[model samples]
Each structure stands twice: as structure tokens, then as C-alpha cells.
Target chain A: MIPVCKEIRKEILKISNASGHGHIPTCFSIVEIMYAVYSNMKHYPKNPLWEERDVFLLSKGHAALGHYCTLAKLGYFDIKRVYSFGSFMSDFGCHADRFKVPGIEASTGSLGHGIGLAVGMALAFKLKKTDRRVFVVIGDGESNEGTIWEAVMVATNVGLDNLTIIYDNNMSHGRGLQIRNPAERFRAFSCEVVEVDGHDIDALGPEIAKRGNKVRVVVANTVKGYGCKTFVQDQYAWHRRSPNDSELEMLLRELDEETI
Target chain B: MDLSLHDERIVMILGDVSVYLFKDFNDKYPNRLFNMGICENTLISVVAGLSSQGLVPFVHTIAPFVTERSFEQIKLDMCYNKFGGNIVSCGASFDYAWDGATHHCYTDLAILRLLPGIEVIQPGSYKELDVLLRSQYDNGNTTYFRLSDHPHEIDLPVQFGKGAVIKDIGAEITVMTAGPLLGNVLEACRDLPVNLIYFHTIKPIDRELVARYSRTKILVIHDAFGLYEAICEVPNLRVSYHGLSDEFCGWYGAVHDIRRKLGLDPKSLKEFIKNTIEKTGS
Candidate 1:
């Protein structure tokens, strides 16, 4: 793992431990993907509303803790402020709200919603005749929703070349509606499809940079918990569990590959 | 259509409804109008995205499909996110009466008004549709326009959230109704000694007007469920709804057919109003 991505995972563990609220396994899966997208997206942390900034939406909003940590790492806000996650009156909730946080282009929590918003935004940029693009991350598990395909079809039909969808194929769908062949399905929808090892920053950067002739989808094959074997081995158990003090220490050590 | 001409940022996404009505607008602005299949949920989400990017979006479809099926998209994507857009729906109540009970839509206004920041407008005529669309389209709040195929020819004053008083008779019974049914309601109340109130805007519902006439027993007559629920929001009133039974309107033919069957037609409504006046001892 890249130092920053590792640090983000560590921060996720710490924040979830402190706050008693975390979609820990889900957040762990997307750390590298989020980092790559943010690093590649044209956003000014200081001026998140910069007229020319490209937009990013987390469609699988359960992974909000990962999104906040990534934004903080990217200088959107102090990383310390995220400790207040899920608290009353704190801007940061388990699900990110766009109005409450900088760099959150659209507030999303429901499955299959963010992709449609991203499509509309991409279509908007096309209507405006601007170079601004929209990138949204959707979980493979969330693909169970029929609206997901509806949005993808709409995006492809409208020729949203400026839109890039990152499908976190973390196999959280292993138990339920598995998107066994996401790349083929996207290609069938007329999207430019690319498969990549989600945990590798180098592999993701290039794919995230490419805008296709139609809607582009990066099928990031990821484990639900990438850095720590404890989480990776029993992901469903840890999917939404915030680590206790002892568990946090062990997870932190495991995140460092000390006892893996 | 004028909205797109006046504002370059306006975009329309349709769920395969009202395509021909917007023919000229699409011709003028090809890139701005998208007939995005019959995906009501996706259309709404797309509209929210357009709104988020400072582009005004209008998603049009049938009433039940857009407002009922995609309720969450409206609640979260549009209202909760504060990404404003215009949701223009056709087939008000039983406008698709020939299409049967599956196509009837009366819950749209009632359910939509429950969302915090949504502006629900049931345009009774072409004038209300034009005026309200011009005023509320770019206000950066999700606005729902419920349009009927059969618009009543009454061109009364229209506003975004204010209700209009047609007759301020000091009669004990106040006949309150909204949208296209106002014409039938008006006709029904003409020979009767009762006050009449009409509303084009349902949400942020004309509270002041409803409150002022709170002393009088308000008879909410409409082809839908929302106008009564909205007026009742003013609190503690002898208000009752005379629309939309607890079952699907199983019988259907046309808007007028359904209206006549439901006693919303002029003659039936007049009889009902007369009975109400007589019952109230006015």
C-alpha cells in the first residue's frame, strides 16, 4: 500500500474506534481507489466550489468514513475534525452530506442513487459545453439495485464520455447479488470498461485518468478489507463494526503488517 | 420551453412521457432535452445531478411513476441534498382513466408535500402552469408540477405558495379545492351559499388563508389527496377530505368519467355541496 493510502486506512480504524461508528470493512476496501480518484480529480481543497473543478460522488455511501479521511488527507479539512463523526451537531455523519462537508459534491447514502446524480452532472457538463467531468464510485454490492443499470444505460445512451464510474468489486455481494462479471455487463451497456487491482495506486491512477468515448467504468477488484488480513478473512463480521480499544491496537498493528 | 430559451442551463429529462409536447423546445435545444427511456428513478437522480452542477433540470413522467416509484430519489437526491430541479408530471389523478386503476395518481401531491423542501404545484390551468414554472423553476428548490391533460379554462391569479379566494361568502361551509378540479368545484359552488378557496401551490400551503377561514368548516374537494392534507397542516380545524377513497379507483374511462363516478363532476359536486350546506344548517 502507498504510505498515504495506508495512513488513510489507519485513520479509518482510529476514527471508527473513537467514534463507535464505522463501516470499517467497506471503508477499508476503497481507501486506495478514493486516494487515486482524489489525487487525479481537479479539486482545490481551498476552493472546493471552484467553477472548473471536476466532481466526485461516493455512490456507496456506507463507505463515507473512507471518503472523509481521503478528503482530509487531500487538505479539504483538518483530519482531526473527523473524530466527531456520527455525533449530533457534527458536520460529519456516517453518511456524508454534501452541504455539511467540503469536497462532497453530492450527498448520497442510498444504494444506486449517486451514479444517477453523477450521470446527470456529466450530462449537465455536456449541455454546458464545459470540460468539467463527473466521477462516481459505486459498490458491486449496490449493483443489486435495478436503478444502477438504469443510470448506466442513461449515461451510456447520452454518450457521457466525461463521466467515469469506479465499481468497487469488493465482493460484498459474495453473499447476495453478486456482480460476477461487472466488466462484461458494463461493456454490454456500451461503457468503456477497464479492470484493475483496486489496492494498487499505480494501477488505478492511469485508469482513473482515461475518459472514454462513452461512460467509462473502472472495475476495481478489491477485497472488502485490503490492508488487514483479520478484516479480509472475515469481512462480513467486520463490515460495519467499529473496533474496540484492544481491537484497534491489534488492527493498527495488522494495518502495519506487524502480525499479519 | 421558454425556460430553456431564457436560461441556457435548463435541461429536460423525460421518462418517455410528454415527448411530443416538448417537440419545439427539443428542436431549439437538442442537447438540452433527453427522453431517457422509462426510468423514473434514474431521471430524478439525473435531474438532481444537473441541479447540483448549477444547471436547472426538469424531469417529466406520469404522476405515479415519477412521484411514487422514485419517492426516495426525490427525498434524498433532490430534497435532502438540496439539489434543486423541476419535476413536471402529467396524468393528474385519473387523467389516464382509460388506462385503468394502475394508472390513476392521487397520492402524488399528498406524499410529495411531506418532503421538507419540495414545492408541490398542481396547475389547474395553462396559466398557472406557465406562471408557476417561470417563478419557481430556478429558485434552487425541488418543485413538483402536477399537470392534467384536461386543464380547466379558468385563468385566475396564480402564485407559487399562495392560495386564491374565489368566493369569500360568510357561509358556514368553505369549499376548498385545488388544481384542475377547481372548475368543477367552482361550478358546483356557484348556486350555493358557501365560501370557495382555490390553490395552485400546495406545499408551503397557503397557511394564512387556511387559518383565516379556520372558523368555517372547510370542505376540501379535489381529485387528489394532497390539498386536504396541506390545508389540515394549519392545525385544529373542522376539515375533512372528500377525495380519493381508501381503494384504487378500479373503474376508469377518462378524467371526466372518473370525476363523475367520484361525484367530482359539477352536478354531483353541487348535490354533495347542497347536502353539506343543509347538514351544516347554513
Candidate 2:
């Protein structure tokens, strides 16, 4: 993992531990995918509200911290607000806040809905003959939702190649069981699947650069926590756990005391 | 009442007979229309997509196919989204009695009414329906208007958005009828002096109207689902509801046979209303 990515995951763990409100395992699973997307965004933090800006919807909305941390790191919002997450009336908390947050495209609390909405945005862009693309990151567990498959079928039927779908296939889900391989499942949905080590930004950067008209699925294989040694291999517990003094010391030491 | 003048932005999603019923509108406004053959889920989703793009969609399909078949799509894509569009579901209230269970939609109202922000309408007559079609297009939100396959001409000066309160208000009892069942209620009311009121709209239910008129006597009659659904709202009102009970409708039959089996016969319905009023008064 890059030094910066490692630093951010520790920060997320700190805030989530303090607030006791984060989908950490899922959030940690998609760090590189988030990094890949926000970096390649044509109209990111500069023009967040630009109608023609490429849209990135976190369809598996539970893993919202990945997107939020990436957005803040990319200078979309202030990093200090991350500590206020999950507080009373705090817009920056758990699920992506569409109304208050600048980068979020839509409010998605329910599973299986974001992909459908993303497909609509993509189709509309296509009809307008625009160069903008829509990227959606979904969870392998969320793939079991019927609406996701419904949307997958529709995207394929309509030949929506411009939309890119990434699956954070960290192998584990809410019930603490690893899911079926996302690459195989997504391939069954007729999407062009790309398997990549989610922690490797080099692989992600090259793959994201190759955009096509058909929907692309990037199956990001990742450990829930890549940077902190305590979480690197422990998928279930490390996904969401408070850092005690020792763990915090280890995490902060890994980041070399960088506040950012 | 002329739909062509105001429905300029209306995107008609066609299914079953809707393609034939609104063929002219579809052809003239091809950009604002689409045909999803036999795929009601996609039909609703497509219209929902169009509405998101700022095109006001008026999705059309037979009631059974649109409501029963693609219920999840309607619940999620349209009602949940609270997108502005018109769901003009035709063949409402067993109007497709000949087509059987796959085509019977007695539970559409019962199901759709559960969705918040959805305004429901069941115009008593064709003239009333035409006015509602125009008003709904202008007034945005998710709306489901029940239309009959059998069209008949009936003249009334009163607009149908507001419930039609019969003038002269003679009898002590008020029979609240909705959709095609209003025709049956009106027919039953002719020989009797019982007063008549029609519920043209269902959601954001005219509670004030229902409360005021429900003082003396109340009897709600309509297609099985529509009537039961409306009655469930005013449970405390001294009202008698007449419709099909919650059960699987087995097979297709003539409209009259279905009505008779469901005890929606004019004679039985009128008698039920009269008896309820008499019992309430005594």
C-alpha cells in the first residue's frame, strides 16, 4: 500500500472507533478502487456539481467511508469533519450524504438501488452524446440483491459500455463469510471482468484508463485492512474495531505521525 | 379535457392494449414514448428513467399487468423515488375479467395505497376521467388513475379532482363510490332517495369531505381492492364496505359474473347500504 493510503485507513479506523459508526470491513475493502476512481475523475473536487462530470456512485452504500475518506483526501471536503462522523445531525456520517456532501450523486441507504440509478445517469449521458462516464462500486454481498442483477441485465441489454462497475471482492460479507468470487459472478452477468490486487494502485490506474462503451467490472481482491498489521489478515474483527492504546500506537507509527 | 394540448411532456410507456389505445399519441410523440413489449418491469423502469431526465412520463398498461406483474418495479423505481410521472393504469377493477388471474388486479389499490406520496384517482365517468388525465399531467407527483376498458359517455359540470358531492343531498345515507363501481352505485341510487358522493381521488384522501359527509351514513363501494382500501382508511366512520374479500381470484369470467360472485350486484349493494344506514339510525 502507498504511504498515503496507509495513513488514511488508520485515520478511518480512529474515527470509526471513536464514533462506533463505520462499515469498516467493507470500507477498507475498496480503498484502491476509490483511489483509482477519484484520481481519474475528469471533473472532481474542482467541479463537483458539474452536470457533465463523470459520476461515481457507491452502490454498496454501506462501504461509504472508503468514498468519503478518498473524497476528503482529494480535497473535496475537510479532513477534520471525518471525526464528526456518526455524530448527531452530522451529514458526513455512515452512509454517503447526498444532500449535504458535494461529491455524492444520490442518497443510497438501501442495497441494490444505486446501480439502477447509475445506469439511468449513464443512459441519459449516452443519449446526450457526452463523453462523461458513470462509475459504480458495489459489494460482492450486495450482488445477491435481486435489483443488482436486474440492473446488470438492463445494462447489458442496452449495451451500456460507457459505465464502469467495480466490485470490492474482499471475499467477506456482513455475516462474516467470504462471498463467491466476484469475477465469476460478474462475468455471468456479461460484464467484462478485470481482476486486480485492490491494494496495488499501479494495476488500478492502468485498468481505469482503459474505458469502453460496455459496462466494465473490476473485481478488487483486497484484505479488509492492508496497512495495520493487526487487521491485515483478520478480515472479520479488523473490519470494524476500536484501536486501543497499543493498536493506535502501532497505526500512528505506521503513518509516521502524519495528520493527513 | 383535451389531453393532446397539455400532455406535451407526457411520455407514454405502452403495454398490452395501451399501445392501441394511445397509438396516435405515441406515434406523434415518438421521442416522448416507448414500447416495452410484455416487460412490465422494464416498462416502469424506463418511464422512471425518463422522469429522472425531466420528461414527465405517463406510463400506460393494463392494470393487472402493470400493477400485479411489475409491482416491485413500481414500488422501488417510481413510488419510492417519488418521481413526477403519471401511472395511467387502464383496465382497472376487473375490467379485464375475461383474462383471468394473470389479468385480474383486484389488489392493485390495496397494494399501491400503501405507498406514501402517491395520489390515486378513479374517475366515475369518461368525462371525469379526461379532466383528471389533464390535471394529473399538470400536477406532478406519482399518480395512478384507474381507467376502464369499457368507455361510456356521461356528462357532469363538476370537475372530478374534488369528490363529486351529489346536489339536493336527499337521503340520510351517503354512498361513496369510486371508479366503474360508481356507475353501478348511481344506477342503484336512481329508484332510491339515497344521496350519492363519488371519491374521485384516493390518496391524500379528502378526509374533511369523508368526515363531514360520513355524519349521517357511509357506505363505500368500488372494485374489491379499491373499495376495501378506501374503507380501511376511515375505519371509525359508520361505514359499510362492499368488495371482494382478500382471497385469490380463481379464474376469468364475464365482468357481470365476477361482480355477482363478489356480491357487487346493484341490488345486493343497494340493500346492504340501506340496511347499514337503517341499523346505524336505529
Candidate 3:
């Protein structure tokens, strides 16, 4: 089977060239997180509307470009369709459009929202005695939103072990510098928190496996722009900046030379 | 009616449907309806979650509790997400007539109208409410219907989405009202020389009708804070926002008494229009 993360990132970079879109760094940060969810989960491909499929919410919606590409790479839709991202009458906008996309569980972008929805879903599954799992990814900066913590309290208090939340600790956001402390807070709210290197796919597998029927948090420490050379190590500005031609060339070269 | 159809219903998250609406239903089908408490934020979020799973949920609560209390939830969960469901918000402007300021819900139309791709309806009567309820179910859409605790009783077509003219146009200025104020305007029409225009939906404000029918000035009769305040984009036309000011209403009294004290009596309405015409000389 094709490695989901690598394939998705490649397609994402291709779409970035067409729209010259920003948020490349944010998209890059969550690539593996999206990969981990899509790859391991028992999802309904033929019928995305199937009720029993595991629910995945991209709470840190700026990372949706990664989700779009991941959905494409996983054979959810044709990869060429992503070329129309952020275009006129395009279903694939910067944020995940739940109505148009077959697999996205929620439409998101406004932070601090998805976790609450996920919590509700988890509660529903628990009460109904269903095996459906709910996964939500939140940006480190997105943790600042009060609603996220509100849901965390509700989820933990309700003992919703069916939920797993991934925090993309890329250390950046709209107003800049996401607070680097969700461990103590998430723990205070009674959630099991696991800090790991976000780029390490191997580290992710074990951490996810370790979460046995407990509401868990995977704090993925990743650089904002992880893959390209010039943009790879950069922060803040690269979070949503459209690449210049020179930057694009450098990024392509960096990808071409890399051996994953 | 088949109990399953009513049981297979959805909540109007950003409005107030009484606890009785479900409590009465629960008496018949105990497991059917859910009263999500007063947690407006969680309530709307849960409604959206239910909608995602293809569960038809009818969320009901007061306007301030539903809209202001859980506005972000409504925006992110229901509107921006584009989830097709019904949000029936009762007690539009004067629903809180005596409950005072915090109880009044006049700002819903102004704020909800700003969101893209949301269908808003203010049903002027019981017949209109039935029509709206049917439309939301028949055509799966993200819709909001504003209702009054005491809506006007009008014998009209079941078709919604259009405003109804309640009075003839023999006067200069039009006194536009919704909810309880419709009856108030009609009562005052007995003594005054002003025409009445009843606006059903406030979000997509019928500019053409307002501009056509109202020649001199327009006086909006509401019980809560009027559109000129921070909540809604007040119309730019020659309009006056009449409602309880920024003060909260905790006084326990009849709604009519409260209306009279707030200068919302039919006599006051006539005088307000007369003063406007005299001052403008249009």
C-alpha cells in the first residue's frame, strides 16, 4: 500500500503551485496526523455517509489542505480535483467543506469548535454502545480558545474513552506564538497527554496503540514548515504565505532530492 | 399523525421551543424528545452532531439563551458547517414582554441575517408556522424560524418566505411590527390614521416592500433592543427603532402593562408616527 503521508504531501505541494496558496506550513504540520487517522481507521470508502465509520474532525482547520490531499491520496477522490482548491465554486476551500467532501466529519476553521462536536459524538457512541471512534486534531494555538477546554472538561467528566485528540504543537497561529503548555492543562482536565515528535510516524503508531480505552491527547511537536529546506525551518510568515517562484523552485528541489 | 414523524424531528437550536413541546411529547413517547437543559452552547453543538449522524433533532430554547448564549456554537456548528437542520427560535421581539430586558429577543434577526447560506423565517401566524415547519422538513436546509409565544392568528396561504401586509395603505407612514406588536398596531389602527406592514422574515428584509409601502417614515415596533444598537445592522432608511432600551426587565407584570410602561401602547405608537410625520414634513 502507498504511504499515505508521503503521497498526500506530494499532492498538496502540487496544488500549492496551482493556487499559489498559503497555509503550506500549517498543512505540512498536520500531514502525518491526518495520515495516521486515515490509514489506521476502518472508514467507509464506498459509502462515506455510512453511519458506522470512525469520525475524524480537523479542528485546526488551517491544516485542511493536508486533509484535502490525504483524502485524495487515499483514493477518496481524484487528486486532480484539488487543483481547484480555493477557486470559484470550489468545494475544497481553505477550510474543510463538510457538505462537498465525502469523508470529512465536520466543516471547520473557526478553532475551539471541533472538539466539542467530537465530544458529543463520542458521548452518543458511548451511550448507544457503538464501537465508533472519534478523532479530532487541534492546533497548538487553537488550544487558546476557551471552548476547547470546555469540551475537554465535558469529555473527561463524562469518561468518554472513545475520543482521541491530536494537538499540532507547531508553535504558531494567526496572532502568533501558540502557548506551549497543553500538557498540564489537559492533564488537569483529566485527559491522558502524550508528547511526541510530530514528524516521527513510528513514534505516532506506538503512542496511538498505548491509548487503550482512555481519552488521550497526542501533542505532536513539529516545525511549521517541515519538508522544504528554506520554508521547512521557517515559522509564522511561512504559516500561510504563498510561495514565490524562487521559493517554489527551492521547495520542489528539496522534495525531489529527499529519500523518505 | 404518525408518532414516528414527530419523533423523527429535529431541534431549532437558536430559538425557544417550550419544555412543554417535548415534555408533552415525552408523555406520549417518553424516549422520543430531548430537553437539552439550558446549555445553549453544548445544546447546539450536540444538535449539529446529531444532524451529522442523520438524526433529526428539534432544539428549542429562548432566543437570548439560544442565540447570544450559544452564538458561536450556532455559527461554527450549524451555519458555517452547512448542516441541514431546523432551528425554531420562539419569542421574537415581545415574547419577553414582562420578563424584562434580558428576556426580550429582538436582536436575532439582525445577527442571524449576516451569516451566509442560512434561511431565516419569522412566521406571523400559526398557519405560517405550520407552513414553515413543513418546508424545513420537505426541503432539507439550514433554516431558522422565529416564532412568538403569542403569534398573530391570520388566515393566509401556507406559503412562507414572504412578508404579509396586515393593513391597508391609506396613511402616510407605516408602523411595521412583528410578534405581539402586530396585534398592538391593529388595535391602534382603530383610532390612528397609519398603515401597518407586518414583516415575517427580518434577515432578508424586504427592502422593496418597505420602500414601496412606507412613504414618509418607518417605525419598527420591537420589545428588546432595536436594530440601531450593536447587534444588528440598522436599516439606513428613515427608520426609528422602538423597543426596550439597553435596560434589563425583571419586573413581574402583564405584557400589556409592560408595553404601556415602555411607551409601546397603541396610543404611544400613533403619537410616535404623528410626531415623526410632523417633524419630517414629508
Interface RMSD of each: 0.6, 3.2, 2.5
lDDT of each: 0.90, 0.70, 0.70
Model 3 chain A: lowest-lDDT 10 consecutive positions:
A1-10
Quote the lDDT for B115 in model 3. Answer: 75
Q: Positional deviation of A81 in candidate 1, in angstroms?
A: 0.5
Query: Who wins the TM-score comparison?
Result: 1
- The DockQ-based order of candidates, best leading, equals 1, 3, 2
The TM-score measured for candidate 2 stands at 0.84
> Which pairs clash inside model 1?
none
Residue range with the least summed lDDT across 10 consecutive positions in model 3 chain B: B225-234
Q: State residue A242's C-alpha deviation in candidate 3, in Å.
A: 3.5
Chain A TM-score per model, please list them.
Answer: 0.98, 0.89, 0.92
Q: Which stretches of candidate 2 lie over 4 Å from their true place?
A: A44-47, A173-190, A228-232, A237-260, B1-49, B60-82, B98-103, B124-126, B138-140, B151-153, B157-161, B226-236
Tens-place lDDT per residue, model 1, A6-67, is: 89989999999999998988998899899998889898999989999999999999899999
User: Whose DockQ is higher: candidate 1's or candidate 2's?
Assistant: 1
Candidates by lDDT, descending order: 1, 2, 3
- Give the range of the ten consecutive residues with the poorest summed lDDT in model 2 chain A: A251-260
Chain B TM-score for all candidates, comma-separated: 0.97, 0.86, 0.80
Candidate numbers, best TM-score first, in rank order: 1, 2, 3
